[model samples]
Target: MLDHLIGRPSDNWKRTQIILTLLASTYLLFNGRTYKLPRSLVVTNRILKQYAPWRIALGTWLLLYLTKHTDILLGLDAPDPLRRMYKRSYFRGTWVLTALDAGFFTAMSIKPAWLRHLLSVVFSFYYLVFADAAEDKTRRVRASITVEHMRTSWEKAASNPILSFFSSLMRPSMTLKKVIKVKRPESSERAQLPPVQVHLYYAGNLDDLPDQTSLLLHFPGGGFVSMPPPCHEDAIARWAVQTGNLICSVNYGKSPEYPYPWAVEECYDLYCKIVESNGKVLGYRGDKPLKIALVGDSAGGNLVTAVTLKILTHNQNLLTSSVSSSFVMTSSDTSASIHESQAIPLPAGLIAIYPCLNFDLSCWMSPSQISLMRAESTTSLNGKSISHLLESKDHMRHQSPLSVEPDLERKSLWRRAFGLEANHAKRGTSLEERIKFMPPSMTDLKGANTSMLPSAGFVPRLAMTSRMSFFNDRIIPPGLMRAMAILYLGPHSYPDFDTDYLLSPIVAPSSLLAQFPKLYMMCGEKDPFVDDTVIFAGRIRKAKRENSRKSHHPEGDSESVTVRIMEGMSHAFLQMIPFLPDGDRATKAIGRWAQQILSSDDDTKTSMTKSKSLSNVAAIVTNEKDMIYRRRMGLVDGLYAGINEDSS
Candidate 1:
């Protein structure tokens, strides 16, 4: 397993990894993090740095480059040399990466701690840019398709001797059996047929899971495309452990192969299908059923919120039979009477981490502000725009064919993969004129409170002269901000994409928003989407206020929203959990929130179960339709006892 994890390197490569680690560590001892380096190695590294600067620097980079991308030139279908060379590094300790970065600084003879910190920060952030969406189809599909891609390709370790040297220090790709094992752990461990239909992670012993435990139905974030459940195993495991609950991080279908509504519908179908021993859907909690919480991060947050709104909006879309049989909340002849008292299976709570709720700049940001943002220092601080970044020689060499990024001729090869033809605008048409509208029913975007106040809270403090990798503690750089917008909205001008409630929860109806269960939402202070979360939370607050004023049972039905701004953090912080301290902090905070919400559910269940006996009897009488049963209980006689007794 250890050999497999270091990418199953060849006999020679194992020796190389040892050599590189020694060299890198020697460099770190001299120029390492400002900690007290071993005195002897420090003196040795300094002497070497003084004499052989370029030699050491370039050689280290060569080694680093080799370790990072051993299989770089090879096609995705290329055989073993142990699958992907450059991949996620944090699965094991980041020692190799640390050594590589330290060597770069040392070779430059850079001893300044601050500069080195800057370099490291840049290195980590670039992970978001380079690694995030870069390996779209080949590796991404490999994750979803499971072990076959990894297992079939391997023949021997020493395929390319030079590449093999670097391969030993690189992260491992999933093997055929390994992917299936982690992904469907229950199926692997259980002797009997698995009880649940999806991938599940139990906090402890599955048998120890209490009848009242809260189940977190997690939909992971991957820009609605890449990343499957296995990629999120560590973070999910931490959450499950911290919250001490059952978590089901599902493997939903990815996009550009299954776009827009496919992921959405998959998550929603799973939401509708999660069964409890008490005989209720995942989100439906009653007197007898366990509570469930809908949880997601980034694109996943969007999915859970959309699922919530869609059900609240067209709850009739759900069959009534799915709700719990033991406890039906509706008494009036709403859909309940005609539908046999079927109400939507509402999750007890929702936890969204930096959700990208609104893509329609017009709906959420002012036109001038939008223009200013789109035109900001995209090239200065963040380097090139995503479009230009993809055009680079190296980027082009490594890019996936199924990347969601725009392709040649301003065409979207990605859209074509999912059967969406790029809408070619007529020559000379303005961007506004190019947009096609959906029906008003879909586009009017009635309620989630998307109307912008026209005041920009803060645009990032990025300037044209700022270094590409520079950052403050409290803001996103203009370049990263713009690239993310392009990443999510793509290069297309679709007004309807912004207005569709599923794509942008900010456009969901206020009534639908009011129906959301308890919401705990957090955004990083430095995240580009800070304003989005703030604005969306304000909309929810405003909607709750309005709905409360109009409702007779406002206090009982009002939705609760909690907003948090994590200090010194950035967007999609959850993705950083295994690697960054801030990411782990954010994850723990969420676990705390999850614990709170689940505990409250337990309190509600306890109170409901403790309902007085007379009230329970009356509740049964209200639902009784059989005259004989009512008379047997004397409910019918009690109602007309005065007249009947007097006449007798």
Candidate 2:
């Protein structure tokens, strides 16, 4: 009886899902958040509302029953292993998850404050449990250390309600691997300052390594607000194990509390100290020249790029100030000379994993902002502003052909039996507008005029349905994106959105970017920021070419900038290593690359005649031997004209 009810959709469950969706959507609409969502999400909401109640109920039944045979509705074109794992572990009871998602929204609409709070917690816990299960596949040893003199005034207790609220609710599952407290010598200049905590993860203890070891400075992404889970630690530990290197995971302060210059300054200072100490502070012997690399995902990726640029600019400032050309190495003693501390050098390489580079609020504005801008625009439709009239169903009904369908009689009379024509006259005008506004589908374009179509015309239905590539990500929703932008860039430290290269590294000068060491960037094609990564790689390529020409070496510079776009993956996939085969393959490949960079002789002193571009880097990095999953791979050449035909 249970199998019959759950194995296939019942008439009762179908009605329940539709009713729940409608109720939740109504709740969201009234909450003032629907207007702030991405247009794609808003459009989906509008389309759902246009459907007749009974039709929605019947269609739900059909879709649920049909989709049970395959994972198409999941919209994840990942490997079979990933799909099976996601199905069995994360979303085993699909109905339960769906109900929980709906209940989360509906709970907020409840009248009683106490009951509302209680239901919200009950719904959200189950939701996070199911969602987090996909990434909770590994365990590793971990350690935390507090960096002295790094805290800012913004970090005072109760200074930020946003940070405080999230901290209370989201508890990190931390397992202490080992704790070692090494006090700074009283003679050190920074001994009196407050400490900033940093997390350390590795496959083995410090004793397992030799005197010399490479170190990775890692920044995990949490939208610059929340704390990273243990899965991220597991990935770092795996990398440490694979490369036989130590990994230092930074625990920077979250935004709205620390905001803008706080985290950036903190990361930059810690990085410099690590370099100045020459690996001594991180429990290293500092006998041999230590290789350091930067790795960050999402917001952390932004920090990596920003800190690297800071180093380049700092060195430039020092050069202009008439500092010596040669770098002065600081002694391994607890106290180093001021000159030695200032002479910090660049790392061996830096890796960015689906980083958020562009911070222009206008580019990623919410639907409400778009509506307000449109309402204020000069353009008008029938004497009313375009956006103003667009919001009204009566105005749309008069303009849309779907609302005035002349051939409704031609549709089969049997449509009524299937709920297709049951509420034809009663349907909202939003359905008509959605149909009118949506890009021409494949069916609409078949055998039509080809010459009149725009250069960038119809998008494949799959691209739209597969929410993986757009603002539909559950991990980084549009609402959260809005909050992060307002919090991170709202501060005075990042005043100029157009020219803040430190905040948005993609716009940095070519001369400064040319000074960068080897760069390795890997992002999932399904990520919303995939195109931005492509564009940044192209800019680096351009910088290399320009720098080479300026130096009178017509052949390009050999600064290895590798970019690998994994197919059928999403942002921050590295955190799911071991459980995800693709994630594991990508992580191991990165480990090998890091190992090669650290173990090699000083390649900076040697000059190679061969020029290396993104294509060449891809060939070297994602070779047949590496066995990476890349269905589409190419270089992005042009910058101003946007992505070229061969890009990504």
Candidate 3:
């Protein structure tokens, strides 16, 4: 069999290589100690274990990309000095996965069909069960936060010597000089959005810029548990410079402590306050009022849409009395002026990237979902003993950067930055719930009479890897994400919006959708929440058509709602800005799209921008096949073409 695959009789070098490969692979697969393995052995095993080029490529990409993605997620979760140490350990530990993938694909590459399936089903069991003895050597801690833990976390963040050491290791060794331009912040000021602190940023030379400016209200996502705008300083800085848009990012009070509705209420109130300010913002003097736009990723996406819905409905009672009683809207102009007023305004456009639009996906049980459920049992994001810390690192990053996250910088940085103690509001207590959902498989993928035995060239095997599924992006399984979404409100926070369509914005009534501003939405096709984004995109159009006849005022052809599903990408793919190639392109696309969305049509500006943005998207999507492996019945591009006059 080995000779058949190798194409000729084995030479001395080939014989020695195969013997060494088998010995090394057998040792790693059956070993009690994993860390002691050599890097050469691991790499060799990964490359030669599977004869099928496609399987090898899929496995290699999966190991590399998932780790990178998770690093971004964990980096945002909480700050810590130990990340580099654990990451180094994790980079070393992916050998087990490499070995496993190589072995599985090696079997599938064999000739006999029944033998292949039998071996696969048997190997699948071993992969999920017996093979998980190697827990992450990168175990920081596995505990919930209390007062003491919080105090210790603050110390860790504040201890300069420790932070410097970690920061040194964590700093980018190479720069994507082309992607990020270092522009000194000309000035920054705080806008009182009540409980929400909006950090307004501008270019260093504000006076030399054009008169009319666009204000971008930005929100960063950390599962709604943690992560503030300042944490995303690089992105905000680049965006402010790239688009020449004055940006204000909110540091909203979070859940667990602040609870549900607080963030959105603050956001809505802040926008109203900006409207009420007249010309009070620091760096001004444009003849016209700033063109207001709303943008957010993840949880921020949810808030962006929620606030927009509240404005559209004009529902004074949408929020609970306890929350909204003190929350007053002080718009000097009335309803008509809301549409026409230059001084006071409704947002010109709304942009959401992978917002958690649907909270009901936890119950979905497709074959892919089942596979994910089984997969999770083997590599739970939680638990010290999880062999796949690198696998879970992506999710762990989102949970917290440090073991305990310090929210207040006064107790943290000193009086100048923030005089107050931090509010360590968390979204949920139970992120470890997925470990229990062991999905039944193979039977679910039945019905096709043919066996999917491999052949010569690389096979199109997108769905089988940890990074992908038949119908979804296999990052965090839908079932697991749903659990996190349920827990996002935390125990102290009341999920009053549980049944309310307003909370899960996609489910909102079509009448409300029709009332929306020119909306631009996006999501990674592999994102578990992708369905939510796609459904919401379609709903906006359908709602507009439904309400147009009844709409006292219908949206004009120019008022656009657009969505882009970046191919070969998953949830939070933009988070990879300046690092991963896809992330870099996605970030650039977002900047160009934002500019085009808010650009004025006076003379050739709008048409020229539209053409430029469309061209930019074409340039970004270099390989269409890699971009979209699987879409929902091909509606990904279909929906974009149907709604707006332009989809750039």
Best TM-score goes to which candidate?
2
What total of clashing residue pairs does each candidate reach? 4, 1, 19
Question: Which ranges of candidate 3 are over 4 A from the true structure?
Answer: 1-195, 208-212, 285-287, 315-344, 365-487, 492-499, 549-559, 601-648
TM-score for each of the candidates: 0.47, 0.52, 0.47
- In candidate 2, residue 517 scores what lDDT? 78
**Which model scores highest in lDDT?**
2
Top-down lDDT ranking: 2, 1, 3
lDDT of each: 0.50, 0.54, 0.49
lDDT, candidate 1, equals: 0.50
Q: How far is candidate 2 from the true structure (C-alpha RMSD, Å)?
A: 21.1
lDDT of 1 by residue, 1-648 (tens): 334567864657767778888899899767766347678867867777666678888988998988766654332233222122112332122332223222232222235644643454444344434532322322333333322222111111222233234433332222111111122222122224222234566556544544544677788876665566655655676777777676777667654455566666666655544421222332224345456778888778888888888667645333322323323333332223222322345677889887878665331234433323333213122212321221211112223322212233232445546677557662233222344864676464433322121223422211111112112211223433333345445444664854689878877767777656788888654454554565566566656777878875555432377777664344555544445566677778888988887778433331212233123333443354333333544865686897888899
lDDT of 1 at 207: 47
Q: Model 2: per-residue lDDT, tens digit, 204-299? A: 545655464577778777667654423255466567677666677877777667778767767777776666555677777756566777888888
Question: Which parts of model 2 have CA positions greater than 4 angstroms off?
Answer: 1-193, 208-210, 228-231, 323-341, 362-469, 490-494, 554-559, 604-648
